[model samples]
Every structure is written in C-alpha cells, then in structure tokens.
Target chain A: MPTSNCSTRSASGLALRAVADTLPLCIAVIPWGILTGALAIQIGMSPLQAQLMSLLVFAGAAQLSGMTLIASAAPLGAIFASTFVISSRHLLYSVVFRQHVTQLSRSLKVIMAFILTDEMFAVSEAHTKRSGQFSALFALVSGFSFYVIWNVATLIGILIGDTFKDLDSLGLDFAIAATFIAMTFGELRRFPVFIAVLASGCLSVLLKPIFTDSYIVIAALAGMLAAYVLGQEGET
Target chain B: MWWAITGMALITFFNRYAFFADFVRYSPGAKVKRFLSYSSYAVLTAIWAPIVFSVDTQTGFTHAGADYLIGVSVAAALSLLRVPSIVVVLTSAAVFFGIRFVI
Candidate 1:
C-alpha cells in the first residue's frame, strides 16, 4: 500500500512537470490551432466538422493538407493518400517510441500511440533524456493537455472566423517554425546528427520538384542513411 | 466530408500505431536501432527545411524573408547556448515580429 501510494505521488509530480514543460509550446500550438480552425471554416467546413476533424484526425499538417486538397475538389482517395504521405514521418516517431513504451499494456500503448505527434515526441524524448526514465503518466499529461488546448483554440477560431479574417498576415504559423528551430539546434550538437540534418534539408529542397510532398519522407530517409553511414565511420 | 475525415483519421492513427501493434514482434538489430535513433532529427529537418529555405515547389528557389532567417538564427544561437526552450521560442517570436515591423 505504501509503495503504491508513493508511486502515485511521484506520478502526479511527473505529470505536473510535464504540464509545466508543455505550457510554452501552447503559445505555438494555439496560433496554429486557431489558424487551422479559421481556414477550415473558410473552406466550407461546419464548426462541428472542423472540431470533429481536430478531435479525430488530430494532426495539424495532415489536416491542413487534406483541407487544401478537398478545396481543390480532390477525391476522397486523393485526400487519404496525401494524408498518408504527410503523416509518414510519424511512422518513424512510433518506431523510436516503441523501445521506451514496451512496459506499457496494450490499451495504454493504444492511448499513447494516439497522442503521438511531433510536439509530443519532442517533449517526451527530451523528458526521457533529462530524467533518465520515461513515465507514461508524464507523456499522457503532456499530450492530453495539448489535445485540450488545441481543440479549444480551434473552437475559438471557428467562433470568430469572420472577425479574425486577418489571422494569416499575423505570421502566427512562424511560431511552429521557431519552436522547431529551437529544438533542432540542440540536436545539431552531435556530429552525425548535424550531417543528417544537413542531408535532409538539402535533399528536401533539391528533390521537392521531383517528389512533391513525398519529398519529406524520401529526404528524411536519406538523412537517416547519411547519419547511419557517418556513424559507421565513428564520427558521432 | 465525414468519409474523408474518417479515412484521414484511420490512416494517421495506423501510421502511429503500426510499430506498436501486437503483431509487430520483430526486434531490430543494434545497427538498425542506431539508425532509428536519428529519425527525429531527420524528420524534423525534412519538415522545416523547405519552409525556412523558401524552396518554392514551382520556382525551386525563393528567398526566405529576412525576418524568418534572422528569427531562426537567433533561436538556433540561444538553443546552442543551452538557454531554456521557452526562452528561445519567445525570443525568436519577438525577433520575428520585431523584424517584420521594422522592415
């Protein structure tokens, strides 16, 4: 009984820490959420539909791309294909996360996998590295908090869609870029990772015309190959 | 519309859950594991490079505005100095907005 109580207390503490760590990211998330909502309305989605998409699909980039395709009158199959391409990067995140979450039960793993996003992966990976342990409670708290904030922000955007028509010019989307830059800068300290980043960025730009949206997946694979080759050379 | 949303949701979830499924029992080797470890850096770079570099799909090269360039540089510098992520993000946002105003 005492052991279980102590574990619960520590879990709550970890959850609190996760919330604190994730709060700043909300500034970035809120703007994107609002923008996504406003754009969804502009593209003829009912408030309910937009909210449902945010609740169900729950991925910003994929949702945005899907909306663009839908606006262009793309078929449902095209939308599904583009969403798959846009979200292929998450496959990598799941693979990396699998190692850490082996201790979790199947149902918990399902929940964990559901909340797996770029921000979630970044925050949770940083936490595991810092604490030398991964707590499911911490990851869930970080993720579900983002989930609630994002959906709420989307609702706000839907409510004020007409009045907030100028949200695009405010450069709110840059917040996501800025946050990513902050995160990637830390990873660049490692030599092999630096090479990998360079490779990915270069290939992404170079292959954009040839590969279009699929370039993200291809370039990322090239980057990983670059890092692997460099690691083999003992340059890490 | 509902069909599209359902399809997107299922596909997105499947991508996230595929590796964790009960059927995926194969363990990766050490070298494969090391390669997988670089995935975050690789994927994040793949996502941001085009936006930051202004790699126009049509024209192939447009200048990334000074505001974005400078904002990202400041963020990278602060992150290198081991500043807190929150500070780095806010500073970069401020720098981005401040530059947009001036120019």
Candidate 2:
C-alpha cells in the first residue's frame, strides 16, 4: 500500500512538471483557438457548435477546414473526408511512440491516444530524449493542459465573436489561408515537398468547379503521389 | 451537428490510436514514411490554395481578389523568412484589412 501511495504522489509531481514545461507553448495556442472559434461563428456556427468542436474534435486545422466547408454548405461526406485526411498525420506520431506505450493498460492507452496532438508529441518526445525515460503522466499532463487552454480560448473567442458583426467582410477568413500558408512554409524548401505543394495547389484550383468541397481530398492525394514520385529521384 | 462532430472526433482518435495498441504493431516502411511526412504540407496547401486563388470561367486561374492576393503574398513571404506562425497570421491579417480599408 505504501508503494502505491508513493507512486501516486510521484505521478502528480510529474504531472505538475509537465504543466510547467508546456505553459510556454500555451501562449501560441491561445490565438489559434480564439481564431478558430471566431471563424466558426463567422461561418455561421452556433456558439455551442463551435465550443463542442473544440472539445470533441480538438484539432485546430480540421476544425477550421470543417467550418470552411460548413460555411459553403458542403456535403457531409466532404467534411468527413477532409477531417480524415487532415488528421491522418497523427498516425505518424502514433507509430513513432507505439513501442514505448505497450506496458500501459488498454484504457490508459485510450486516454493517451485521445490527447495525442502535434504539440504534445513534440514536448513529450523531447522529454523522453532528454531524460532517457518516458513518463505517461508527463505526456498526458502536457496534452490535457493544452486541451484545457485551447477550449478556454475557444470559449473566449465565441463570446467575443457574438458581439461582433461583419466578421466575414473584414476578411478574417484570410487567417485560415494565412495559417495554412505559414504551415506550408515549414517544408517548402524540400524539392519534393515544393513540387507536391505546387501540384496540389494548381490541381485544386483547376478542379474546383468540378469537385467543389471535396477537391481538397483529391488534390491532397495527388500531392502525395507527386511527392512520392519525386522522392524516388534520390533526394533526401 | 452531432454526426459531423462525432465523425470527426472518431476519425481523429482513430488516427492517433492506429499503432498504439499492441495488436497493431505494424511499422510502416521507409517509402510510406517518406510519403506521409509530406501529408501535412500537402493537405494544408490543398485547403488554402483554392481559397486564395481560383478559376474563372472566362479566364484561367486567377487570384481571388487583390485583398486576398496581397494578404496571402505577405503570408508566403513572411513564412519564407521563417517568421513565427502566429506573427505571420497577425501581420497578414493586418495587411488584409489594411488593403480592404484602402480600397
């Protein structure tokens, strides 16, 4: 019994440490969360819907894309497809850390997977590399902390969004484009990646009239294929 | 509403949980890894490209508007400069509204 008690206490301590480490990244998350909520409302989502998405989906890029599709009155299938493709990158994170999580119980694994986000993965991976150990508590704490911060910021945006009118006219949706563009810059220097971006961007524009909302999925797949083909050219 | 929310949530969790379970210890090969590494960038470009530029029936592909054109150009330039994402967002937003105000 004393062993159990000791472990519990240490777990809480580890959790607190995780929170402290992740606090700095929270500053970056706040504006993103707020912008998501604001864009949801601008695109005609109810405050409830926006907050619920932040809580449930918990994916900024997917939520933003979903709201954009919803605003355009896109079909439900397109929304699901976009969400799947956008979040598929999480699979890489899961694969990378799967070997370390085998000891955890199924339920605990479920919780861990639920909160597996890009930021959480980066912080936890860094900790593991630095300390030469993996703490489930640390990873969960980091993820849940971001989760809480993101939702709170989303609520704040929802409140502020309700008070404002003509958000669309202000070109606030440009934030979505800007955000994606900024994200794309990270890998643009790689030749294959650059070709992929160019292929996907040009294909989507040309196919827009035909595919409408679902064009994203088609173009993204084409982009991946382009990258794969170029990757065979011997460029690392 | 619940349908969209639940579907998205489930898909996201499924992706994260894909290889976590002991039963699914499948490791992707090098080629697959290389392919998936570019998914985020490809998907992001696909999402925004159509928004910032589009096809006109009479003309070829064209920028959506001068405001969006300038705003997205600023975003691309800043991103190339390795600016922080949040700053890129805010600065491009300012340019967006600034252009709208001027025109």
Candidate 3:
C-alpha cells in the first residue's frame, strides 16, 4: 500500500513526473490550442472573449463547435446543445475517475472536475488504470500543465493569427481526423467492438441530418449497448 | 453570451461531476464497463465520419470528397504504421494540400 501511494515522491516531483508522462500529448495539444484560439477569433470572438473562454470554459470540443455555431449565428440553444453533446465524453471520464480518486476530498473533486479535458482524461485514465490508484496532486499538476499551455498557446495564436492562418487552410486539421481514426482502431481489438464501430458509423451517417452532433452521443450509447449485449451473451 | 458561457461551463462541470460525486455509489458491471469504454471511439467516429468523407464541411453528405479523404487515409496509414501523432498531423496536412495542388 505504501508503494501504491505516490507520497514517496515530493508533490511537485509527482506532478512533474505526471507532466513528463503527459509531455508528448501536451506537445500535440500546443498547435491544437493555438488553432482553437485563432479559430475562436476568426469565428468572431474578440481576442479577450476568446482568451476568457479558454480561461473559464476549457473544453476543446465545446469551444471549437461553439465557435462554429456562433459563426453561423446559430440559436443560443443549439450552441449549448452541441457543446453539451461534444463534451458528453466527460461523463465517462468522471465515472472512470471515481474508481481511482474515491479518496479525494470534496473540494478537490470539484476543482479536478473543472479542468477535465480529453488530454487530461487520457493521462489520468492511463495512470489510474496502471496503478489501480491515483495521485490527486499528480492529476492536479497534469491538468494545470495543460491548462497553462492551452491558455498561453491561445494567446500566441491570437497575437500571430495572421501568420498561422494559412496553416489551418492547408488541411492541417486532417491530423485530428487521422488521430481519432487511429485511436478508434486501437480500441477495436475485439470483434464486438468492430461491430459497434460499424453500427455507430452507419447510425451516425443516417442520423447526421436529424440530430447533428447529438448523433455522436446517440451513436456512442448505441455501440456501447451493443457491446454490452454481446458481452453478456458470451458470458452465458 | 456571458450567461450562455456560464451555463455551458456549469453544464460541462456537472456532466463531469455526475459520476465523481461521493453520493452516487455507482459501480458499473463488466458489461456496462465494456460499453462505457467504447464510448470515446464511438463518439469520435460519429463526429469525424462526416468530416473525413464529406466534400463540403457544411453539407458533408452531398458527394465524394477526395482531398480530406486522401489526407486522412495517408495519415491513418502512417499512424497504423506506428508513426508519432505529431508527425501524422503534419504529414496528413502536407499530403492533403499536395493532392489538391496536383489536381
């Protein structure tokens, strides 16, 4: 149990170690953050508002989609709906966290909940899954690293928006598509999961016109439900 | 807009807190765990399937679009080949524009 605790290391040491583990991801997020900030402006947020959004509401998917919706002058409700849908993944992350971070204080949990982004979720998930325990400080600093870098990158993006503007147009955003595709395939080692992917794909394409981004939530639930059923059948 | 931002932030936080709260003694079974684990994949695909194949960003279902498709395929192949993600991102962008220039 002593070994399981990260208190063996200093708090900053543990945090930095976690940060080091997450460095590669943090690097990948730099350009992504810059693009978000710059895109926020291009889509019509003032520099101050864009920066504030990064400061206050820090989810990448929500900001990106919210920006697009704002550009289209979508109703306030639609913007909120899409932001909620895009960020539905957080619910899973929170559930996953409960398994490892059960001992964290209430205030810590609330604060930790505030900075839950995809990158942070990935890092924390890997750590918790590996050790069967979690370091609250480690999670905090890792989240902080992302939080600081994200805001800094965003400001840089705003200041240099003109120069980097061309980079986005070059289809540089393809990386996101490719990255997610790769990650999805990595998780599809099981046959049932492949079926889930196919089902989700079909359902999303079909539901695109109707539910839009909300289809993602629906498709995810549907596939997971399918996997659950298949797994149950196997058990029997 | 500020109200909406606050609303979104609150909703996002609550979505996150929904599970981590102590009051909820929720533990998912193996079946549900399998399902929850795949949520990310399912959602990611759901969001991007349209983007990768769609010709136009706005109306993605209209027709065949090669530029992004080609770029994504190349990047996905490289990723499967075990290349780093940063490289995958840059390479895909280059390949996308390259194909466009050629066309």
The DockQ-derived docking category for candidate 3 is acceptable
DockQ of 2: 0.46
Question: Where does model 1 exceed 4 Å of error?
Answer: A1-6, A234-236, B56-62
Best of the candidates, TM-score: 1
Q: What is the C-alpha lDDT of each candidate?
A: 0.84, 0.80, 0.72
Docking class of 1: medium
Query: Please, what are the lDDT tens digits per residue for candidate 3 over residues A1-236?
Result: 77646555566577777787556556656776788888877776778888888888888778877888778888889888888887887888787677666777888888899887766765665566567767777788889888998899889878766567765665545555665665556445566667677677767777776776677778767876776676555433
Docking class of 2: acceptable
| TM-score, structure 1 vs. true | 0.93
For model 1, state the Cα shift of residue A182 in Å: 1.3
Clashing pairs in 3: none
Ranking by DockQ: 1, 3, 2
Root-mean-square deviation of every model: 2.2, 6.1, 4.4
Q: Across residues A1-236, which tens digit of lDDT does each residue of candidate 2 receive?
A: 99999999988888887886666456556767887888877877888988999998998878988888888888889899989877876776787668668889999999899888866875676577568988888999999999999999899889888665444455555776877777677557878879889988998888878865457667877898898897677565
Query: Individual DockQ of the candidates?
Result: 0.73, 0.46, 0.47
Query: What lDDT tens digits, residue by residue, belong to model 2 across residues B1-103?
Result: 6688889889989999989877775877777777765666676688678878888889877886899999989989998998866688778888897888865
lDDT by residue (B29-60, candidate 1, tens digit) is 78888898777777777777777675666886
Reference-based TM-score, model 3: 0.77
- Residue A153 miss distance in model 2 (angstroms): 4.2
